[model samples]
Target: MTNDHDVVISGASLAGCTAAILLARRGVRVALLERRSDPDAYKVLCTHSITANAHPVLDELGLIPALEKAGALHNDARWYTRWGWIEPRSAPEGPELPYGYNVRRSTLDPLIRARAAETPGVDLLLGHRVTGLVREAGRAVGVHASTPQGDREIRARLVVGADGKDSAVAKFAEVPTTLHENTRFGYLAHFRNLPLQGGIGQTWFLEPDMAYAFPNDDGVTVLAVLPDKKRLPAFKEDLEGSFLEFVRALPEAPPIDSAERISKIIGTVDYPLVTREPTAPGLALIGDAALTGDPLWGVGCGWALQSAHWLAEAAATAAAGRGDLDRSLAVYARTHRRRLRGHQSVAVDFAKARPFNPGERLVFSAAARDESMARHMYMFAARLIGPLRFLNPAALAKAAAVNIRHRSAGVSPAR
Candidate 1:
């Protein structure tokens, strides 16, 4: 069947733009639709922390240079636990993990959108809001959208929902999602002249709360707090006040209040943990449209770009070749599940606001004392490696030994 395009992607966010560029470069005709017409508008309810795992994707898209030039920070990380600080070490070659971007969505959205629109086989449909799915014989085949011009219908070989958490395509297609409760809502703001040391970010796994201090580009720091839901009364009473006080309460707290506030304090409450099967018939989901896990770890941006790459590779020739598109979608779905399910499972547990289990105690404790264990933990957190590899037999043994040594020395193990 001849269609107007090979793929009609809804939502011009990160995933939509990435997929359009990739598929168009693969010689597939793409129609990229965006609900917003403003080129400068961006997502504000995000931490803007792109994990190191996304470096390869950015490099492939030729965006790394521009991102770094835009003031992205290549900062090292230091995790503070009750036992002490767990500073990961690198080899003589330098930092083992590649640097991730802290670029604001304002800067990145335009870059990604412009790149997608400039591609040869892509048609950018701005001001087009998708209202429903077009299905044939129970298979999603296209999208029905309302544009600034008027209502429109576009048929395609595949429909990609790169929309945000409340995806219209997923809703119209009746895709099932398992919503996990997120007890710790996040509040953050960008600050200027935060006086970071050696450009290292901080993660405090405090007893009942957690905090992050990331040095972004342009000499600005993105500081944030993830407080339990029960603290809503205090937080709601004063967003900025509660936010500042919480940071000051951390051990060896920085002079955050002294820094110039570059942006208003932004927050999100009871953000739902959304998980769904990424493929359904001729429809596929990417970014938050696929799986919205805990935001505390800040993995959403990286996963969005990575999922787009996965789908591009899997379905590059499905529409043109005489291959089964469903089979190609299956490959993408299976790979996505295998690569991310373990991480998501663990994240769901943390999202529940429960304290760490014994295994977590041993791992974090060992990571604090041993360089090898710290490297493993760092790599896992950076998402360069999967959860299984991070908890390999040798690593677990090292963690156990580290805790044993701490006990022998009369030092408290990390809880």
Candidate 2:
């Protein structure tokens, strides 16, 4: 059937913008709908750290230098545990893994939105919110959107929900959802002159708790601390003070505590990390809307861009007139699940308890003590190494050996 556009993407967030840009680049007509009137608007609650895995897509869209010029920071990582610090190591060429850039959502999000608008065949409708999906015979065909002008219909060949964790389009598409008890709250802020030690992004895997501070461009930094639900009462009482105090409580938090505040401490309590089947007839979900995950791994932004690319590729194939759209959606769904499910599954599972695992503790501890081990741990943390690689028998055996050697050397084991 003839439609106003090839795709109507809800939510002008990173995923939506990326999807729109990708599709438009491929010659598909795209309509991007945003609920906010301000084109510069962004989700302040997010860390806004984009990883190395997302670089290729950004490069393809010609956004890498743009983002870097937008005050994004290029920083390596270091992990902190009760035992010690694990620093990042250099990699030999070959599209170095775990490479990443960090930019504030305020800057990054708007830049992407603008790029999407610039792409040929892409029309951005700001201040318009999609209330529901339009379906015919149980297949999504378009979206019902409400603009300042009032409610109206926008027809499209496919509808994409990039609306995030509480996605209205996903709900309208009638996709089944599963929610888990995520009792953890995230508190964060932007800071200036944070006394960063060793020039590496750091995360303190505190015993039964965790706190992180990432260095960014423009002399700014992002600090976040995640405490169990039961321990949130204090933070909720005084968001800034508790957040700062949590960071200071870490074994190596003096540097962060010394930093000057560049923004107010923002807090999100019991933010539900959810997952659902991301696709169905004529519709697909991207980013948090498709698979809400724990922010602890800092995988959200990367996954969002990556998933958008996946959908764009699959959609191009499905729209070829030779393949069934259903089959295309299924393929996209399977690929997403296979690529991310294993990793996110482990992340969600680990959220249930403190960081432990004889092998893990051993390797992480060794990383803190040895530079080589630190690189391996950093590679894993940065998502350079796949989950299966870490689970390999050889890797496990190596971890065990490292653990024994460290113990014999009188180094405190990471737990």
Candidate 3:
């Protein structure tokens, strides 16, 4: 049977918009729906830092230039652990290392959404909320949505849910979901004149507690703290005070006292991990709809963009009627799992609010003392490489050698 569009994507955020733009560019007709009517609406609770793994995808979408013009900071990262700082040293002879962006969602979301709307074959439908899926012979074929004017049935060969953590489409499609518990909550606010060393983002792994200083666009720096739930009472009692105290206690912390607070502290008290199967017969889920991990690692935004690229690449041919849709979707699903499942598992394990394990201690301690180890750790943390490679036998052997050398020199591990 004929369909209204090739694909009807619910949610016009990062994943949806990226998918819409890429698919449309490949001659596929797309309906990009967003529940919010305002064009400038953005997600406030995000860490707003995109990882290096997603840089190529964003560049492919022609957003890198726009992002740079908007003053998005290209951020390198430094981590402070009990074993001291793990700083990756770039080799002057080697190719330049990849960098991620530190731009607020307030600027990022609208910029991308506008790009998608202006693309040739994408229909940006604002104020359209997906309420249910249209199923034919036990396969999803379309969606029923509540639009500004009235309820409407949008038919398509494939339906994509980029609607985020609490996905309406995933619910309607009855996808299997697994929930993981997070024992920490977080708060973040913006500041002015808060300069990090070389404008690099800093993450302090204060054992069970974590704090970050990410320099963003236009000289704005975001300060965030993810303290254990046991410290919630103090933070709830006085957010500003507790936030300041927690950040100040970090080793060689930024000069927050001299900086000006620019935004009100915003936070989520509880963010449970959500993982779902990304595809069915004629349905697919991208971004947070597929996997919502602990946000402390700042992987959400990057994964969203990357997943959109993967989905669009996989489905474009099928949507154009040149290939089987289900087969294409299966390819996308496998690719997504292979790329993100290990990272998600690590993030969930950390979200349990436990102290670092022995392997973690060895890696972090060695990284602090050895440049090679630090570079590998950086690659793993940046999501540029998978966990298996990072924890390979050779890496573990190198870590052990580094630790032995430091011990021979009588240098304290905590130093």
Candidate 4:
């Protein structure tokens, strides 16, 4: 028997939940399936930080109030170089408006799924695992799923794969996915009362290695360190202690030693990530499933929500008779490619090599040397300005000029 709906979404994480909420609001009947039995399930290995641009979508979804209640921290980030800290300048609208935020996935994922359940046209199906996809003449028309009771067939005009980097739906659809080799690994954990300059996020760039501290809502700070894959053996031996030591070794590591750890010092060797094209045929992949970039950029959650919005807009338009499923899928692919392909390409390129270039050294050094440069770099770090936008011809020229002037004055650019 076929369980019918206008759309069927697999995976109930950030991307899945957001897509469901948006589509349901458009009066489209949606059957959102999550393999997990828990309705509040979320990704355990995520950074859970989102950019300021993503806040608009949160507002559109009416999630701001709930997020605030959940104690999400507004994260205005600072970039630390060998020179000094480049702090985010104050904006009139405050931290949330100018910078991004940090909310644990444990808090955010459930909040989003709960909102999906409240959506009028949404049918939340927990503990149902999709075993296969049902296709009609080379187009995705439905899905075959395993419910606790038994096997079931769900037929829909559109199928969305919101699963993470490893998407089962994309595999079943036989969409050719491109996978790249990652050379870095990550270690992370949360600590309480860490003197991490409470209320803001900081990232320290240590040439080939990187470390970051995010002051989350619960007065707990999440720390992550990205190191080369070759160091895995040493890292595994003392995962927790080594991670803390690595942070402390940085030029401006917070006084984490004085704090109490709330969670185990968990670590994963996969620092970088891979992704396939986000959409194909009758199925669309969002979030990590589509294009997982280096987590070092902290763009995953924001991209997930943004991609959901794009997919929802396209899906809704198609369902409302303005377009067909194929057209909708094409629109989603184009929108997604336009929004993130360049950034992802750049991130991948950098992740594969050492972390810095001479140009980066000059820019960061200038920020440490000049307060104005620090503020500008902070905006760029917050993603308010794109790579070229911040490192524009004029900005680069100014940084170069500053370097030359400082050198002539017998001041060396900070390493």
lDDT of 1 at 365: 79
TM-score of every candidate relative to the true structure: 0.96, 0.94, 0.98, 0.93
Candidate 4 C-alpha lDDT tens digits along 1-415:
2445888999988888899999988878899999999886668776769877677789989998888888998877777766677665654455533655799988888889999998998999998899999988888888899999899989887889888787898889877777666677887888888876645788877766778888887777888888877777888887876787788887756887788888877656764466677776778888888888788888889888889999998878675445687888888899888878777766877787475777777788887766567767767655556777677888888887777877889976455
Give the Å error, residue 351, model 3: 0.8
* Candidate 1 regions with alpha-carbon error over 4 angstroms: 93-95, 410-415
Alpha-carbon shift of residue 390 in model 2 (angstroms): 1.5
Worst 10 residues of 4 by lDDT: 88-97
**How well does candidate 4 match the true structure in TM-score terms?**
0.93
User: Can you write out model 2's per-residue Cα lDDT over 1-415, one digit (the tens) per residue?
Assistant: 8877888899989999999999888778899999999989998887668777777888888888887787787757777776666766664553444577888888888899889888888899999998877889989999888899999899887889999999998888779898866657788888888867776577877655777778776777888888877787787677767776677777767566566787877777777778889998888999999997788778889889999999988886455344578887888899889888887777776676455666667666666666666766766666667778766787667767777887788865444
Against the hidden true structure, what lDDT does model 2 obtain? 0.80
Ranking by TM-score: 3, 1, 2, 4
List CA RMSD, all candidates.
1.5, 2.1, 1.2, 2.4
Ranking by lDDT: 3, 1, 4, 2
Worst 10 residues of 1 by lDDT: 91-100
lDDT at 107, model 1: 80
Query: 212-231 in candidate 3: lDDT tens per residue?
Result: 88988888888899999999
True-vs-predicted CA distance for residue 211, candidate 2, Å: 0.6
Per-residue CA lDDT of candidate 1, range 1-415, in tens?
Answer: 6887989999888899998988888888999999999866678888778888888888998888888778777757888987778888785676566667777787888888888888999999889999988889999888999988899999899999999888888988899888988889888898988875546888889745788888876777888899888888998998878998999998868688788988888888879889999999998999999999787788999999999999998987995455789999999999899888899998988888877777778788788888878888889888988878877787788888888987899875444
